[model samples]
Target: MLNRNNLKVWLKSVSLVGALWVANSALAESPEEKGLRIATERKAADKGWGDSIATTKMILRNAHGEESVREMRLKALEVNGDGDKGLTIFDRPRDVAGTAFLNHSHINEPDDQWLYLPALKRVKRIASRNKSGPFMGSEFSYEDLASFEVAKYTYKYLRDEVVNGEKCWVLESIPTDRYSGYTKQIVWIDQSHYRPQKVEFYDRKRSLLKTLTMSDYKLYLDKYWRAHTLSMVNHQTGKSTDLLTTETQFRVGLEERDFEQNALRRAR
Candidate 1:
């Protein structure tokens, strides 16, 4: 049997150890931690190491039954703690020449977007509310062009589902901002790479509005994985956007200065 003083000391030590363990476990898991885990995986899928440049062709089909094609060139640089900045130049259709778009993604706060039109000779700031609007008359919304930050939405793990013969985790996400037109989104993420293989968007009415599918994945730089094609179809309007990534280059030298408002006008 232990003396009274020794028993008290032993009890105190056990209590301290238990309290420390609980605190450590709580610190290991936080909302930011969960969000960062998902965001990191998404960022890797989008702009991984050695992925320096990407060129894509966008085909837009409107509800009125008109079709248009546009070519875009994207160069990514300085992908580190400060966040990634990319310069996108629109090439094709003489009417839209010299048009450029710039994206500066911040870890916090809304991303800054600007579009420079040759005719106007001025760069226009893209409003956050207009994110849901079509991009240059395409079926793709402005939000689609912007990088998907985990901070923009709240996520919940739904269940496991089969997509393209791969087991995936179905996650339901709700936009955190009022400016977002989508009421909710369902995403299918592959278990192996954590890449989103498909997504479905619901409108303000909570009705299924659009479905996006990604396929034709190719590995780059032995670490980076990219999807060559992404197709989005609007169920309500019978319109669709087909984006084909024709070329991509990785690990090329780029700087934040290249993605500035002043550079937007001269992107081409």
Candidate 2:
């Protein structure tokens, strides 16, 4: 009988074999089909997390190495048959305190998002056309905050490459949204667990705009893997952002109403 750690290793081996089999069996599939299949598998591996809450820290850095930090509370809800809902409530930095952001993602159509400004005491709707703009002076854009929905992009398999010691499948994902600021994105998804290790965003001119790397992954429920930190670097502006999260609490009784627009203003 295998012990806890051995059991984990065995399970991972089985998952790896399954992925290999899937990939090998799809030799006759087109690049688009293969890319979509891999993406579907990636999403399936993270299903049924239900809900979660996390304490987060956002560190923003300018080209001159100047830094500022903002602390926030993040809550997320898993919506069946569609995209997820999320809310972020800022708690620190006197200037940005009491600010909140809400997101409702969808498989098809533009996502709905709103930001609440405590000083103005008003909730501002995020325009779809402006989704590419930076979020709160951070390297991450509003579009980056939206939950991943396979339908949002058209996929094509690029090639295999090793990134950070992990063999990954390189995929080309072109946004379907006409208003999207990006022309396409290149994603490196690890062969193991199908987790994304890195992604490169391309601007409308197909120029590399930024790169995001996810690391410090921790397994939850012995099944799901969540990244503890994300680093986004803007190549053109020499700006960067680091998002760090405390241990996430999964299946935290979060409801849809908890992510409503009104809730943004009420966020503490």
Candidate 3:
């Protein structure tokens, strides 16, 4: 047992195993780390747009196949280190005309939302507890309309899957907000451009509630990719809503004052 040759061989084997173990450990990546990296990259891909204005037509459909159209104008201002500010002014349908919705999204905090009802002629505060409710009878909830900040969710990289012929990374994002309507959301984001192809929202009971599919992506300002066609379908109620952007202009000289609730009341 004390022979020099035998001792040398034993030491060599042990050294090799130790070296391999170190290499493998260094190469391995945790799912949480990878998920955060992917999400951060996705967010980084859509930065540097000072402001934007878009004209969108919302098509609401019932289970009975009837459709109603509402035209709206959207204005947004980018905020650094926080979520953006948005204002939606309804312009069509005599009943909903002059109605406005104001939102100021933030990171790691409850969003500030207000709705101006034309009939009431008074702005209604949208409480955090009520954010899970539908927005104007649409499939999307008030919380869903807020800007998606990275810190709002804890992400997990599930696996790679093909979505609508495009290979994408299937990511599971759990909302950190306790008042969020959904238990979790699964998103299929394309690996190439980091654009989301589809998203599935789960209800409080962990049941699938709604699905949103984005298509017809067009690049704005040669940097940001905007989906012109957004279709959201409710699996529970069999209702659907489509938002078609008729026009979009970036760097529209908009400022924070334009998104204020006072300005919304005056403009409407």
Candidate 4:
């Protein structure tokens, strides 16, 4: 019903409209937007774990290869609007036995942490400024053991690469918390499973400080993923800590009250 010229013009208009729509959609999402979106999606996917329990053996090594072992039990609860709560109870290493630590993390506020010392029969609230200190002589800081919340960091997608035969997305996360020990952390997350495989920590001076590698992940409830072994190597001190999880159980029916200070005192 139309001449060749008319039909050509009509096709060109439709093609132009499609092109414009694609361009607009692409422009709507910047690199930062895309990075945050990826982080949010990964966070959402990891939600609903309910509760979990794990037994960990932490082996600390000094520069000269001296080693000390500490065994502990960990219990965690997922909160709705706030960051998750966790309690760690020390069992072995007689010097530190009957010691418990509790942490309550918030979205934008400094985390509330307490240490229960059976020797003193008192609960010592950890100062926000001291959260950067190592936890019980381990390489992991108190801040490192807190539950990872997306709001705690601002993310920037770096690139995609293969790590240990797994395809991973490299992401740089700047801590939003001022008291964080590290200037920034670069993470390698597996693309297929959304599990973190490695992280490099940069110190306050923007120098390479430590590297953490997680492996031997096992799936729980057919959805949740947890790494069984976490190894942290301190570059400056030549110290290392390896946390081997001997047992892990999810959906332990843990309640909010179980992570309170009173519960910490009664942990042993």
* lDDT agreement with native, every candidate: 0.78, 0.89, 0.87, 0.89
The CA lDDT at 167 in model 1 is: 89
How are the candidates ranked when ordered by TM-score, highest leading?
A: 4, 3, 2, 1
RMSD of each: 4.3, 10.2, 4.7, 3.3
- Please write out the lDDT profile of model 3 over residues 30-95, one tens digit for every residue: 777778889999999888888999999889999987998879998899998999999998898777
* Better model by TM-score: candidate 1 vs candidate 3: 3
Q: Candidate 2 clashing pairs? A: none
**Model 4 lDDT per residue over 1-268, tens place:** 8899999999999999999999998887766776687788888889999999999999999999999999999999999789889898999898889899898888788778889999889999986654689987999998787788888889988899999789998889999888899899998888898888999999999999999999999899999999999999999999999999999999888998999888877887
Candidate 3 Cα lDDT to native = 0.87
CA error at residue 238 for candidate 3, angstroms? 1.2
Top TM-score hit: 4
Residue 141 Cα positional deviation in candidate 3, in Å, after optimal superposition = 1.0
What TM-score does structure 3 among the candidates reach?
0.87
Kindly indicate the candidate among 1 and 4 with the higher lDDT.
4
| Count of clashing pairs, candidate 1 | 3
lDDT of 1 at 68: 88
Report the C-alpha lDDT of model 1 over 160-180, residue by residue, as the tens digit.
799977788777878886777
TM-scores, all candidates, are 0.81, 0.86, 0.87, 0.90
| Candidate 4 accuracy as TM-score | 0.90
